[model samples]
Target chain A: MIKLQLPLTEADVRQLKVGDEVALSGIMVTGRDEAHTWLINDKPDNVRKLLEGSVIYHCGPVVSKTDGEWKFVAAGPTTSIREEPIQADVVKEYKLRGVIGKGGMGPKTLAGLKEFGAVYLHAIGGAATLLAKSVKKVTDVIKLEEFGVPEAMWILEVEDFPAVVTMDSHGNSLHTKIKADSDKIAKELIGN
Target chain B: MAFKLNKEKFRDAVLELIRLTSTELPRDVIAAMEKARDNEEPGSAAKSVLGSMLKNVVMAKADSTPICQDTGTNIHFVTIPEGISLRKVEQAIIEATQQATAEAYLRPNAVDSLTGKNTGDNTGVMAPYIHFEEWDDPAIKLQLALKGGGCENVSTQYKLPDTSLKAGRNLEGVYKCIIDAINKAQGLGCAPGVIGVGVGGDRATGMIMAKKQLFRKMGDSNPVQQLDDLEQKLLVDLNKLGIGPLGFGGKTTVLGVKIGAVHRLPASFFVSIAYMCWADRHHEMLFTESEVSYD
Candidate 1:
């Protein structure tokens, strides 16, 4: 498996292709529906630097606190399709080198990845407790009060988080290919 | 003498049920996943995903952490004796739900429709949705299932004779509809999942029956031979799609296909499917003779 550090370079992301399993170690940010809307609508300048060459995860983690320090209990990828509308802009404006999520994104996000030299990573959906072990620490969090726990942005430090690149900078999407292939097989199996 | 319910005892028992349901994967589900894992070619994405899922299941139980981050909606199917009060059971369940959220057995999932505010306590309208049934036995039975949002989104209803697919209002039509749902689901519903199909009722009842089928153990067979045959055939056909785990493509697309039928009006034929992900967490508890047992 390929090991990736946070704040990856364009060249680093471009080298990856669809179906390459990777272990990511470094900093990442978690965002969901409300956080995505906030990013595109508010156009916040604060996170721009943090997002540059970094990945945004589509996750709503179950977190806890002990001795005044926060920790993750369960953190798994949510469906990425929900962020399709705003994902392209997030990638382009943020100069993000990678997007880590599950299920995969739509055509717009694929175009964004190709244009911006980024890759879309698919974290295993439903493998929460196993994946949470990769998170080394919880550095910070934002929008906890307004958007609640699930929608808040969680900035984290991770080590060896596992994912597969289902969409690459080369414009290959496993989701699209699988959908088309499955559809044709489905039709034949049904038989008109 | 009138039977009196012990509200506190029931509430505490419900909390434990919630905890076990959230943190543990059912044995039948785990066995199916292991079988899928063994069938996949080594070094394939499908095998890797199944491996992770199995490991995660073990870890969740060991640490008593949630199996999945979503924690999902809490659905309760309550069966009680005639003398029991629905209000009392619902109140106990609600209190248990609140306690579960605080203890991290569930994430506060209920959000206000307009305001988009989290209830913080996992209680509100339709929270921990309850369905009631009357049973002759003196024991009380409660079944809880934690359904994740991604899988729930893919669950759907279909009205036949869909001209587009040329599906008729028969078992054949039901098969076609289920195939379509599985293909469309592709890895979004977390493939290598469970497919629950309900035929014959109105739109609402069809869906209700579909979800009810989920409580059945994965290994159990429908007593109806026709439905059982369909279940077996569909399982094979779906795996052929090669959607694999999370759509990475390989073997083992689905673990099981369960179908239930209900009588409907002559004019309407609706087929409802409730898709469940591999992290299927469902368990039942029984209370009788002042003692409780869980499965």
Candidate 2:
């Protein structure tokens, strides 16, 4: 397993291949539908500055605040296909090196990953408590009040956050193969 | 099975159910996961993912936190004896839901569809949605299933004789529909899932039956021999797809496959699947006038 730090260089992402297990360290911003929409519609520089060379996690975390300190109670990856329309744009606009989510994005996003040196990391879906253990702290938050806890773009500092490279910068996607194989098998099983 | 519901403690009992269901997965699911883990090649991604998932399950139980952050929807299937005041029970559940949200046993999942705003309290119109069943037994039985949104998105319904797959309105067609649905779901519904299927009912009833099948404990067989056989067959077939945990591609795709059939009108043949994630956060609480026990 390779260990990659935040603010990853194109070299770091390009070296990753499909099926490589990785542990990410440093900061990652949690962004779901609301944040992605805002990023594409507004193209705000404030958030864009934070995204350069970093990963955007598709997560809606259950969080709690204790004495003004934010903590992630449960944090797991959400489905990523919904972001397909905007992912390529997000990667190009933000200079994103990686996207952390479950369920790989579409060919558009895969093309974007190849064009811009980035990879798609598949986090363990529904492994919230275990994943939250790696989040060191919530450094900051955006749109908390307007979007609510789950939708808010949480700026998280993490250590050794586990994920697997399902989609590589070279345009190879484990999802593509698994999906095709599963489709063929389903056809055979309908007869099996 | 014949008892009274201690109305005074009913809300508290539901709250306890919420906490337990949220933090801990039932024993059967954990065992299935363990078996899947053991079945996988050592040091494979599927094994590692299952390992972390099991660790998360244990930690959430020990720490009293939600097993999954999404904590999807709070679906309650309540069975009560005659003369029971369902309205009062509904009020109590709403209160319990509010308390659960504050305690963090559930996420505020109720979103205003039009406004795009969070309800914050996990309560809105029909939120914590309760479906009531009347039973001869005097005991009040409450079953809670907290389904996550990711899995919910992948839940699908089919109109059979699906020409694309050359499926007909028979058991064969049902098998085809199910297989096709799982393929489309891939890991999106969180692989290593539990599939609850309803066949031969109208759209509404089929979906209802499908979801109710989820409450049946993981290895329990359907009363009807044919459905039982179908369940067994689909369970084996789905895992063979090797969707693994979170669609990582491994031998254990589905933890359980439950199928229910109802009589349907000739005009409509709908098969609905309520695909559940591996978390499978469901529990049943038996309430009497004096005490409450959970399974």
Candidate 3:
């Protein structure tokens, strides 16, 4: 039931810990597999300027054009582990304070969250259509004609977006904790 | 003998099916998720997570949008009449996929596996690999599925030697293998999901059958009595693992267990398990000549 806002400052991100409930509000950038590669390998200019103090959502949205106006139909969080190799670097390079995605990122991203003041938020996986309602507006879109909708970087204004602090600046990760516990149960079942 | 299909009509049908399936979370899945939420007696944390998930599905349906941002990579299986022309069907699928992807505003999920290039259309060479089976029936059936990477990654196959099993593919063995997969996958496959099991075939055939079997409606029992009994037993055992909703820990880790089996030689047994997350977005359609006139 804890309430919060987005475009989190370095101090704000640092104060949060794993297991904190949050309702994010502010401008968050949407990026997924292709967009992550473009950021790390291509190093698109002004990417830092665009992301500084902003939240990055690992999502690709379903959108349509009606009478020349683009509207989102559904947007849901993609798995963050797919971006594990590049997430920490992307966070550090862009000075990002928050990332929103489903499942959880791996150790490197967790380490990066600790080194840099950042937090990883878990959105409900498979709730794309419902999650899109949080988006108030799309300010601008980049790389659309080239990368298409899912791969393109969509800059959106969202209000009170819900998420949980699955990973925090202190290197705590809910995913890791759960996995370790599940593995213990698994091994016992195997009589190992 | 040429079977003709109206390309536009076929395409529109596919698009509408995708839209319907994407927005409306299937009834069985909703019931499963809700049951999981209520049965999560260990703690309120997991219950709350499942509750939010239920709410999310309802909201997405009301809004006519995708329930997940990862709309998923389109995978289809087409069974066409022997005399039907497949060219039109194939083209319709690709064209319909592009249009639906654009209209549904699906995320560009198709990437070149080797080069990592994004195919904006969500189709490339063999991208939407259509497994075509020539059936004696006059009608064509298309099974459409959006295979999200999260669940796709958790699919597993075990090449079992014929001599290793004392009971000739017993339920215990299948149960153990499934538990092994879930344990290995952990929360990676976005658990509290369905497991599609394909048993007694070659490696490739078993895998394909596993994927295809997911198209079956949730909660439907297997036609084979032994397999049905095994499915029920495994469903109970899997839930006991307490992987809970999204692996946060609780009851109800799996919504259902589906088994598709084919006869195999006495020398080998191949078991393939494919996990489909709660998103489990899929639909089925039957197209007959009587439904619409073909040019």
Q: Model-by-model lDDT, in order?
A: 0.91, 0.91, 0.77
lDDT of 1 by residue, B1-295 (tens): 3446788988999999999999998898999999999999998888988998899999999999999999898999999988998999999999999988888778879999988999988888988799999888887899999999999999999999998878999999999999999999999998788988899899888988998999988888999999999999999999999899989998888999999999999999999999999999899999775888999
Per-residue lDDT over A31-98 for candidate 1, one digit per residue giving the tens place of the 0 to 100 score: 99999999999999989888888899999988887899888999999999999998999888888888
Candidate 1 docking quality: incorrect, acceptable, medium or high: high
Between candidates 1 and 3, name the one with more favorable lDDT. Answer: 1
Candidate 1 runs further than 4 Å off: B1-3
Candidate 2 to native Cα RMSD, angstroms:
1.5
Interface RMSD per candidate (angstroms): 0.8, 1.5, 3.0
What DockQ does candidate 2 have relative to the true complex?
A: 0.74
**In angstroms, how far off is B254's CA in candidate 3?**
1.3
TM-score of 2: 0.97
Tell me the deviation in Å of residue B84 in model 3: 1.8
Q: Model 2 off-target regions past 4 Å?
A: B1-8
The worst-scoring run of ten residues by lDDT in candidate 1 chain A lies at A93-102
- What's the lDDT of the predicted structure labeled candidate 3? 0.77
* Poorest 10 consecutive residues by lDDT, candidate 2 chain B: B1-10
Q: What is the TM-score of each candidate against the true structure?
A: 0.98, 0.97, 0.89
Worst 10 residues of 2 chain A by lDDT: A183-192
